[model samples]
Target: NESVWTADQNEEMSNTSASPDSVSLADVSAEKATQGSDTDLEVEDPEKAFAGVMGAELYLEACRLTEVVPVSHFIQNLSKPYVNLNHHGLGPKGVKAIAIALVSNGTITHLELEDNCILAEGAIYIAEMLRENSSLQELNISNNHLDTAGAEAIASLLLDNMSYLHALQLSGGLYALKQSHCVCTFVSLQGNYQVKELDLSHNGFSEKGGQLLGQMLARNTTLEILDLSWNHLSRKGTVALGTGLRGNGALKILNLSWNGIGNEGALALGEALKVNNVLVHLDISNNQINNEGAKNLCRGLEVNGKLKILKMANNPLTVEGATALLASVRKNHNCMMEEINISNVLVNETFIKLLDLVCRMRPELDVIHGEVEGCITKIPKQHPNPMKVIQKYLKEHNLQLWDFFRNIDKDGNMKIPVAAFRRAMMQQQNIPLDRVQIGELVRQLDRHRTGIVDY
Candidate 1:
């Protein structure tokens, strides 16, 4: 015969067996029976038993349900604060599994999934996860095949008020999105206030894209660093962007390199600079800026004082343009210019003398230019060669040549790689040699055709 126990009966049994001294063998047996029944209930409905579990257990369950091959590194990184799964070839399904796992995860703060073939579907999954997850701060999804759909999903995620992401890298795939879709994404970004740094390089942004970006920049205030390098933001687009900059006050660093924004674009930026006071670093290198553009920039520099680093290298500016720019900096007593890079422009005695006077006024100012030209006939025959110029500059500035070499030699090896040497000579603030002189020096130093130069 079997009997059913009611709640009242169970309570009565538990109360009766509350005291160890008054407990009997029958009471102990009943308590054990109740425990076994509860265990059976848990086994019958395991999902209900573990419904609110989080972290690794939850991630593993997601992986199991999605049938994803759990990479060992990913599994290991589930407990870490930073996860790097770059170049893992994790396709849509794999990223979906990871997204499901990370939806409830609170540990990961930085996640890099670059070069993974996570297409549109995978991006959607990630976006959905981000809608729920708030711990993640930085996300790099560059080099993935995220097409228009994926970009739209990401843009929607940014529009969400719950998103806490600070840095977003969606570079290397913007060319796939149509102009309308790109405009949609940029419009979404305009409303976002959380993201501070954005990388949109390697994407061929046309005039439409530029206009969209300009409109976004006009309203968006939280963005600080923007990289628009290696794109096609030519005259019209650049002019629009410059118009946006005119009213913007939050942006500090902007990279517009390799965009063929010519004299017209430069004039637009010059107009923006006259009114804008917050921008600090501006890179307009490799643009088709000529003497007229340089003059336009000088006009801005004369009145504006906030700019610190200006990179105008590889433009078609002549010595006159360079001189005009330096002279503007000299004329502006309030200017805070620190480093000016015009490495592709030749300089003459007039420019050199003006640079010397400017340097004397602002000893910390570093000006970079190319080989001497234009007024070579006026220079005396006793003019020092490029090597002597470098030595003389270093000695006069109280900088050691070995220190420059050591800085480039990262491995502490006595020899510097040819590429590293050239880069250091051209970019290092202490080195006074220009590109043309550096090339000749490299050829003479590397006599054996070895790919390195001995100090």
Candidate 2:
């Protein structure tokens, strides 16, 4: 493969070096010749960076993608985790070249090809690459005109090689009912068994595709995060998703904001959450779910026990409705509440009491309320214990302890009681811990015998 690429680079060098401005790209070594500028990037081995870029350039040129990024930039950043080739007008031809390069390159894990206009033909090449590549984890192909054919092909790639792909971003128009149905069809028949995240935001979706997604969600246990925000999934579509959630035991984070899901849709989801023991993070922000919907949602949340994070920004939540929701969670002794976003909602005289409750229950809980800058004022922290410092560090990095908490608290409450700690950890994150060991750890955290720890 290197030999073939060298030959192509040699041909490209000879053909384009007619002017003094053109550098001998094939002969470039020791230093990358930027266009009258020196590269600011530092590398452990300059020689390795040179080789990486040369190989990428040769492979790209061989596939007739001449109008690509500068070789110097690619060399300096070849070993980085992500490659952003957005807005480069990488049409079908360029997309094919990139696909070929990606198959051989092992370092790049996240590839962004947004707005590249890589139509159906280009998508085929990408699918072929996905079949062969092993390092890629995320692919952003948004704003590419890869219609139904392209959609089916990418969907096939996800199903065939599920381990390599954890995230797929298909955000933009052209993701209507037809495209959604096409994607869901592949997922159901073939199976995207290992993908954890899927973002299809800003697509002009309707209920036909929503039903398809519901059908797929009913069985897929591997998917953990889903974003369908900024769409047109009104009550009809959201109801179907709710029905699917009723039986789903895997999904943890869901974003359905800006979808115009009115009170009816909110009611449906609230009812579903009553039986749902998995979902933890939910975003229904900017939906038309008014005071009635808020009350209904609280009714479900109070009885259900898994939710920890809820975002309701830009909803028309009146004083009565907002109070009802908060009161319901508090009265239920919900310690799992981590964050609540209620920006742009009407807050009445109960605002102070609401803030005080949140402050006492969760000193670390982030509350985004009202439109003022820094609406959530907090008191300065007291001196922390060494255990608290260690916990904070672990939480910051999402280390094993935090993962354990997340796994055990499947209902999204962010906090776990002392009694259920061991069982939940083993059942959720696959950590094998005995009752005694978990008891000791809980004792270390719960010094005052509060029976709770801020996870």
Give Cα-based local distance difference scores for all models.
Answer: 0.75, 0.68
The residue-by-residue lDDT of candidate 1 on 17-46, one tens digit each, is 433123211222233223221100012344
TM-score of model 2 (CA atoms): 0.68
**In model 2, which range of ten residues has the least summed lDDT?**
35-44
Candidate 2 whole-model C-alpha lDDT, 0 to 1? 0.68
TM-score of each: 0.71, 0.68
lDDT score of residue 251 within candidate 1: 91
Query: Any runs in candidate 1 off by more than 4 Å, and if so which?
Result: 1-53, 177-190, 374-455
Q: List the pairs of residues colliding in candidate 2.
A: 306-411, 308-412, 336-413
Per residue, candidate 2 scores C-alpha lDDT tens digits across 316-394 of 8766677777777777665466557787765644664675664445443445566332344755334445345446666
Worst 10 residues of 1 by lDDT: 33-42
The reply for model 2, stretches above 4 Å from the true place, is 1-54, 57-61, 64-76, 354-367, 371-455
